[model samples]
Target chain A: MRILVCVKRVPAPGAKINITADGRAVDTAHLGFTTSPHEECAVEEAVQIAEAHGGEVTVLTLGPAEAEEQLRYAASVGAHSLVLVPIEEVDWDPQRTAAALTATISGIEAAEGAFDLLLFGNESADAGGFQVGVRVAHALGRPIVNGIKGIDVGDGSVTARREIDGGFEVYEVPTPAVLGVKEGINLPRYPTMKGRLASKKAALVTIEQSTEAGGQLRERLHRPVEQVSETVILGEGPEAAAAVVDVLEELGVLA
Target chain B: MTMLVLCDHDRGTLADASLEALTFGRDLAAAAGVSCEAVVIGKGAEGAVGQLAAYGAAVVHLASHDVLTDFGPEAWGETLAQLVASCGASVVTACGTDRGNEVLAQLAARLDEPFVANCREVDPSGDTWSLTRVQWGGSLLEDATLTADHKIVSVAHHVVEAAPASEPAAGTVAAFSPDLDASLARTVVTDRVVLSRGITLSTAPVVVGGGRGVGSAEAFAPLEELAAELGGVVGCSRAVTNNGWRPHSDQVGQTGTRIAPQVYIASGISGAIQHWVGAMASKHILAINTDREANIVTRADWAVIADLHKVIPAITEEIRRRRG
Candidate 1:
């Protein structure tokens, strides 16, 4: 089995996102970057599948040269190979990104062979366009589903689980299919010291590429107006418990 | 030109998100000086047709094909694409749910047009529509332009509240059947598995959430006790989920569940922007934390400065005592 997983290097989430002076991109001077959460999980899933089924896992990314850091990190976690489609821009619209990926993937498959499974995060953490995987799958004329949390690989098909409001729906697509994986599908393993040492020597195959800017063009990026409020402090520590109960009562939930 | 709003439903009931999309599409159509029509696809969409008309749909188009019994991205995309051409729609829109964004992207790919997701604002005055969309789950915004003969977009989830029109439309329902190939059923939903039955995090009226300050997996006991006493569910921040203290299903953040409970008791959570966007939807927030400067505390309607390990149990005890 051959599994391919796509990841993006994004600024560590949970911090306040700041825009650069040019208002076209995020300010990265003081920010640390990591693999987007969902994609990280995807890497772990691919590695696990490869380990169980005795296959090879290849990690692919579309970002700047600095994205090597993320590729190396994936290597440390157990990806057998790394491929980088290096671009100069901070980001591309979904259409352009998908086009570049589709082209690059076709080249890779021609040189080697078609991967049985192609995995992508349901959406990127920063852009969250939620369309690249769909476009790529459509361009390649392959079946794809997004928001998948569970995967059961079979002889010739893969069954995926998509979480709905109350339950999960299952979809079984044939091999050589694409899937947009969501976070929480699996817990990613930490890189061992031996794995880390080996990753430092892991060579990267960089593919320089560019595409015409898609129809969606970014004009500027700005922070949303933060909502300010005056918090009423009831009390401190355990003493505040009674006040908390009173407020809950006022909200009519304590009844 | 007409703007076609794709409405979603479950079984027979229209989804609230679909109403929000209708409200957004109606307003956008009025601004662009175009007619607004709605399309509902698949089984049981007729149940939502009347509500769609009430929400300012000039005409409701019910599209049903034998293959559309279950949700399928390619099939729905094919249906919407054909409807756009048949209806002469210049713009297509839907709510920014997973399915909403997915189907529109599929449609955009089919039509070879640009599709924008989670848009907060749109300007239709120019030849290329200028749009402001949410990035980082509402922490940041991007001003953009969509250059296409056909504009496809999804309204940011919960950014605009669903509102009914003061004057209802004719509520006319028209049947639409799109030309679909048999191969489009490859990605259709095949089976369903019910994991749990009861109040989910999104539906619960009260949510007692924990964060990094909750310390360890075992320490979540007090939070669980408090939540159970309050007849609510327990939620966690991304930090807790990363630490393996709680499952991601219990996480309240951009990548997790967007909860709109009656009251969200946030304890020990620093309220990162991702987490804030999800909890911000709650009607009321009560923050309990050791640091006064934490983001959740400042934004909370009420707060308590203390250790969650002590405060959570005390709150549970106090509530029980009061009930007795």
Candidate 2:
């Protein structure tokens, strides 16, 4: 029942996102850093599964040294262990990141034991390559399902549910499988006072990995054209109700 | 070398997003001085070859196998990898739908190459191609470069409008069979559970979204009724889903379904960043919230500063009265 959750640290974008002067990255001076939303939920899901099944939850992250914050956050929320695959660069291409993660996971499993489940965010909030988890699963020779919202552990099998347009698709993969979990899987818990204290004292395990760049490289980062809309106040409260209908009719929604 | 566009279809009907991918692949092929072709996998793909040529595909490769009767990411990727080699394709592209991205990712893993998803623009001028891709579900854009000898990409859904050539190419259809192991079927789709039929949240022209302000699960009745009257479906913010007022499938946000409805009627939603990302793609947004300064109100095209409980029924009544 052991689970490993992979997370990524990304800039916590606000109402408006500002790009760096050179158009190469986000302007992080004013913004804070947090685990990607989906991965945060993935960590929560891992912790919940471990808590219920009587096993340990290991949280792993690949990013700069500052990514330790995300790992500690996972520990504060009941993760039993933490592993940081520290990368010196701002970001690693998906191929290299997957390779590094596959290597790290292999080493961990070899030393300890194979985790029953490996969970990753459906895609990173920042880069959103949507390849790392699939690549890693292939490299590790495991069946993988992406965009999973619900997971049920059965006898040596995992039933994963993914929501489609009108309904959901189900897949059953054997244990020692991989799943890319989405955000709505669970609501992440906040760190308690005792948990925060434990997190502060928790030892952060760092893994040094150097990998070559993948074929895809970040040339620069640029902001999309801002969509500015001037809100036209129809009316106040129930009184504005008629105007709302008028707008809908004008938009042909009522046709 | 040819540029290959992977046509996404259900049985025989082609998806609009796949045509968009063909359009993109055609442009990239032109830039690289190569012919633009398309590859369709699985059952009923042979029927889509003509349509692929209408979008400028000169050659259509139909890769149908017994094991690939349904969508299997690994099998499709493996098939595309073989087609890339057999057809001498320098670049492979697909529409960035859920399946398209998944298949291309598998192909990238199988070939040990780079694959970019949600690309809005691609320039295949030289060995190194620069592209702009969406991040955070199109909330942000990233400029990146691909230097792979065989470039694999997925055009962001709805970024490029699909257009047919003035004169159709009358493309020839060819069949391809890849050697796929039975092991790839391990993760294939086993069962599909249709929750509700007809228009879904993604395809609904009008979406009525409820938020935490709706108070309880029962409070969504009004939103549902209004959506029904408009011949659409109901959506909700993550907060509503987190509160257990609605299911996760009905949630609209960064992690939820990214909708492109004609108009989104978001009621009682404060419009957090996550929710805004999903709803932003809608053609028009009408925010109904008490707080005028709420993020949804400020960003929406139209705002009604009112309690949704009072406004929703009133609007429904107004619409009914107008029809009568």
Candidate 3:
């Protein structure tokens, strides 16, 4: 039961977003990148599945050189191996990202063996494009159970629950399948210091081949006008309550 | 040959989301210089599919089967793969609701095709089609081309406004029966629990959400009572979900369900950009918070700087005591 968890390095959920001065891309100079929120859950699921079944878990990521940070993080958190496909050119869309990931996974499979299961987050948080997982599955020609919230593996097949119109719909798919892990599927684990250290030293298998997939995305680089403001949080002192009360009443809270 | 849109339905009834999907599908396919068809998937949705013609579908492919009695993702994905192949649709589209996106993702995988989710708009340019998807939680737009002979797309909910049917045009309803492998499904839902009488926050006209500032679980009672009186639904911020006081389904934020209602009354919410992205699409928003400097006050149409503990109970009591 070999499993591959696909991930992306994106600005953290709480990270302050600053568009580049040119307004074509997010300004990452001061921002710290981490595994996408949902990807963390996906990686956790992979580790849990690997621990439950006898297998190894590998993390795959596609991005610039700095994207390897997330791959190293994955290795620290119990993944057996990490693979990074470099898209040195900034702003690779999902099609290209999926292609690069496929090429890297193909090389890995050719060397080792094909994966039994593939896991992905519902979507990346920063880019918020929910396309890579499905695109990868399609490129590989595998059966897929998507956006699964509840999954139980047995009977040589995987049973998963996908949230439907009102409730949930259960689906059974054979092994050698791709499935996107939905939010609330499981609890994500934090990387330990030991894991972090191990991951940093872990060599990432980088693939340089291009998968001839094209899609236009340069238009997103344009900037939008924003009226940014700030709120100074008064220190959490005893007087803070008095100050807050005064402010609230001045705004007509207490008549 | 025209493109086909899968119509989602509830036991013999059509979902409004499906209608919205139908409208989007019809408009998109027509813009691409092709006619549009619809496939209804659910138990006994054959009759309901016939009404899709009002939204411009020329054919409503009905796949009513016993194996489909339950919404099996594998079975449905297989059925769609077969239907798409047989119909030879250049593209298929669905509403970006939870179910629509889930099923569409599976179908895209099964068809071995690329998919674009939460696309806000699609404009055809000769042989190529351009789409603008909500990038970065709707903060920015990613305008790109489809660049595929076949593509699956999910339109963002409410982004493509649903217009009334222009005319009642009759279309052919073909019954599509496909074989489903029951043993392949991983999990099966044995039971369902409906909260707040099944009034989902996404469909509610008025949503009253509570956050960490609500102080305690007991504070939700006022919100629930108020929602009940207003004939609306109760929602919450991610803080409540993080606190484990509410299920993730009730959470309203960037990662949670995005809702746009007529009126949104936020209580105790700090108005984080994530929360704002979810509910700021509402027609009107009223913020109730003790912090006059709260971001919600600026994003909201109206601001009431008050302690929700006192203001909410009073509002509910006033409404209840006011009577019909």
Instruction: Arrange candidates by lDDT, descending.
Output: 1, 2, 3
Please tell me which model should have the higher lDDT, number 2 or number 3. 2
Best by DockQ: 1
* Residue B132 of model 1, lDDT score: 97
Between which residue pairs do clashes occur in model 1?
none
- Candidate that scores best on lDDT: 1
Chain A TM-score, cand. 3: 0.82
Each candidate's chain A: what TM-score?
0.97, 0.95, 0.82
lDDT of each: 0.91, 0.88, 0.72
Indicate the TM-score of model 1: 0.98
Docking class of 2: medium
- Model 1: share of real contacts kept: 0.87
Error of 1 at A187 (Å): 0.4
A1-255 per-residue lDDT for model 1 (tens digits) = 899999999998555777799998989878899999899999999999999888988999999999999999999999988999998889988989999999988998999999999999999989889899999999999999999999989999999999887789999899889999998898899999999998888878888777878899998999988677789998888989999998999899977
Q: Write the per-residue lDDT of candidate 1 for residues B147-210, one digit (tens) a residue.
A: 9999999999888889898888876888999999988888888889987788889889999999
| Two-chain DockQ for each candidate model | 0.80, 0.71, 0.23
1 or 3: which has the higher DockQ? 1
Evaluated on chain A only, model 1 obtains a TM-score of: 0.97
Off by over 4 Å in 1: none
